[model samples]
Target: MTDSCIQKQLTEPGQEGPVTVSISRQVMPGCETAYEAWISGVIEAASSYPGHQGSNVLRPSASTQNRYVLIYRFDSYENCQNWESSALRGQWLDKLDGLVQGDAEVQRGTGLEFWFELPELPVNKHPSPHKMALVLISVVYVLVISLNLLLAPILVDSGLWLKSAVIVILQVLLMTYLVMPRVTRLLRSWLFK
Candidate 1:
């Protein structure tokens, strides 16, 4: 009900072959560490069960209600369900029964089942400066390298390695200032909440 019309329009509710599931949870007032320990244990144990892609824990953002997001990316839809229904899963869920407040909401995936034609994209279409900046930098690098070869001798003679050094410096600064912080912020947002 809180979702926007555009959000609804863009999504189709159904299972594709393989999908990641997100289980969001709120830590009981003082149970943050305990909640994490339990979930981490489950993640380690899931390896023996097979079909588990991996788990990403998201801490709650200031705007969000839930405090934690447990994202379990499964290799397949069936595999995800199997993990949910498995005996080990039951044990894990049982351990958290009263430790966390409210039931968890599991989002099947980021959308797009992924096939030969449509491989998985590293980042979703969210407003990610990290991804976009990287793409732009890559294109610029290709153009610069191609152009550099033509002007190579003169530039080299002029001690132009400094230009390349400047670019590398800029890259590191941008990554540190603009990209990595936001990424880790969101990553920890998923973890600590």
Candidate 2:
């Protein structure tokens, strides 16, 4: 990767929850096959790391040598860090040596950010409103059932406003860091199509 591409680090602060790291790389003119091999190796290595969730790759367009975007997900920041700091990751990066152009552009965020965009597409290309509503309803149903079961005793002793506030907070946090990511990915075929 080019020096310019290496400017930003993979994970930033507040990324301790379920996180998705996007690595954008410009493959050399004739090294597509080599780059794919490197990606497979990296993914295999990452899958063995603690807290590893899953990964997705956006291949370059058939008509152009565009950048390839690799999205890797992990269950927690500590787990992601362990993979990033490993000698195995370093070796994989080293293996890419001259197969890619400049340094890779890395971005990190909690997984919910991907819910709005169809995987392998530009960020603005969102899923249909109907599909989004379906997903939202499913999530809310799960959250309500879960919260009712887990917080029944606490809610019975709390004021109405306090109960509402606590429930909302829990719903938002759970949806953002856990539920949405897995749901969106699980239903990608229907959500995107």
Candidate 3:
């Protein structure tokens, strides 16, 4: 299964900032199969929704029975709200009525907080500062060197400030929407360890 978010340009005119919604739930004993099926159906239904980027599921281990974390991504808050208010999602939740132990806790956020989140963990648990700095430096180094090499000639006639601004904006966008998520996911074992 693909574990990465779909690579799409998440920023466009009139679009709200990208959003991440997390749903944490506890399944009743012997309801894992039913819960899994319900989750699949919801994901399938969500895929047809506007601005749906992707999703990630973190199933509980033997040591963490009955717990599951579902992370969904949308290009904007409005789009995510649309999904949340949709009848299809309502139907899915209805199916879970007796199968789940209690009300699922939901959390939502935008910006770097979404990308930096660790699967199955609380938001307050972040990577160490040293690991974060290393990742940031690595990503920025590669982006700056590659982008500068490619854009320098094109922006040669432009003012230095203009060139710098363009590069900075591009870097921020790529880091926020693209590079950081992939890198963090790839290095999760090391970073989290």
Candidate 4:
């Protein structure tokens, strides 16, 4: 396959930029903590590498076979590759010889280390997903409230505090009960092995 910087790559008929996610499992016994620490290092170290966008680490509520998901969102396939083969991670991978399985993504895909292919996402400037999700939810709620106010001025409540409180409560309930589960599910796929 051809490797090219995603930003410079022209959009092709059937090709799309990828948001690659890796789901790897530890092979040797008693190295779960080491594996996680090493993967976490890889995620943090990725920021220094080219095309590095952002990363998320997922661990199951209970450990079974020692699995972890490392979701690295990159600017392009080329950037992901640059991060993968860099000296920044060489030692980390080498350290995995007796800890993690030799095959990077054995059960995650046919053979590739990556699990899922997402349409290219613009690099997020936010350091936290909660912040990003909150901002988006807030903006959408504001738009809906504004439309309601325009339609019926009488519904505008007496106290802004009360209205704001109501919104906050509703958002919290929705987020806790509805949103977090889906995020957990998406991250869990990385441990299919």
Candidate 5:
């Protein structure tokens, strides 16, 4: 983790809401299997902690080189910090001495801001508020319009409020799980510029 624990201090402390921490680790050549095993163990250990929501691992791909990006979520910053600062986590990290290369790159964010993170970037940088807002506006517009058009026939007999509720729920789900990640990745260069 290197000085990432220190880096966390650079960001706001005690931030409310779900806290997401992205950890990027470059696995040494031929250590992929061992790293995977280690991941399973650490994830299980982390899951035992209070407020540990879950984790998703983005394995190395051509674009990501050998880096494995682990996204860990907790209910709040306090819980996240507890897990981060735990001796258990330290022990797990210490076991990585020979399994990976260099220190892990870590970035922490609250709520929607995590979507805008660029894992490959060395430093934690967020898109300007205006840029983020613009991209979000565009995404919401497209999603809402497209969803309405596609659902109109099926929801024709539904009441206005019912239809609106459905659309809103679907819109949020798509935005969180599907559309946003891809859009953020695609427009990262412009968004971050």
Candidate 6:
């Protein structure tokens, strides 16, 4: 962790929704095992905190240039901030001394922003709002049309609100776990250009 990282997280107020923090660090030679143990402990500690959704560890890969990425999520920004500023987290950061080559780079994202983030790329800049809106609109339009066609028969007898709710829940789930990730990767060049 860096002073700037801590300062920014402490001073800035985040939006009220799910928030994710990506911590990227390059481990010192031969310190991989220790770094792994440290990360496990910290993640375990984090899971005990309020609003902890879960965490995902991206181990060093060829494309990532051997940098470990720890991505953790909280149900809301306030809870995430609480865990980030906790003494337990500080103690975990203290143990990072000499284990890593440099101060970890941290990136925070909420809502749709995380969809635009590329873990392999360190560039913090996000696609412009118009571009994101365009992509989202295109994807959502297709989803809506396809879903309505597919579910019309099944939901024909259902009330309007119930049918709408089903479509929205499915859309959200598919967008979050399926479509967005693949679409983002496919359009990375244009999106990040």
* Best-fitting candidate, scored by TM-score: 5
How many steric clashes does model 1 contain?
13
- For candidate 4, write residues 1-193 as lDDT tens digits: 3555555546653244544555545456677777777877877788777666567665633432345556666666566667667786787667777776555442211111232222121222112335434544564576556545653454375476666665566554554345444443454344222
Reference-based lDDT, residue 78, model 4: 61
Q: Write the per-residue lDDT of candidate 1 for residues 1-193, one digit (tens) a residue.
A: 6578556456333444447665667789888888889988988977666667566666776534546877666766667777888998888888987788776655554333211010112222232445445544664575556556755665565665776765566555555346444544445433222
**Per-model TM against the reference:** 0.51, 0.55, 0.60, 0.47, 0.75, 0.74
Order by TM-score, highest first: 5, 6, 3, 2, 1, 4
Off by over 4 Å in 3: 1-15, 62-66, 119-137, 143-193
In model 3, where is the ten-residue run with the lowest total lDDT?
Answer: 1-10
Candidate 2 regions exceeding 4 Å error are 1-16, 62-65, 117-193
Error of 4 at 20 (Å): 2.2
Q: What lDDT does candidate 5 reach at residue 133?
A: 86
User: What does candidate 2's lDDT look like per residue over 1-193, in tens digits?
Assistant: 7766665435565454687787888999999998999899999999999989889888987522378889888888788898999999998888988899897767776544555543355544557667888789888988988897899887898888888899899998788668887887788788778
Clashing pairs in 2: 1-102, 1-103, 2-102, 2-103
**Where is model 4 poorest over a 10-residue stretch in terms of lDDT?**
106-115
lDDT of 3 by residue, 1-193 (tens): 2434333435554465788888888988888999898898899999999999898788986523447888898988888989999998988888998788877777787655565675456545667667777888888999999999999889989998999999999998898668887887788888777
RMSD of each: 11.4, 10.7, 10.7, 11.5, 5.9, 6.1
Clashes of each: 13, 4, 0, 0, 0, 0
Candidate achieving higher lDDT, 3 or 6: 6
Candidate 6 clash pair list: none
Comparing 2 with 4 on TM-score, the higher-scoring candidate is 2
Assess the local accuracy of residue 149 in candidate 3 as a C-alpha lDDT between 0 and 100.
Answer: 96
lDDT of 5 by residue, 130-192 (tens): 888888899999999999999999999999999999999999889877988899889978987
Candidate 1 global TM-score? 0.51
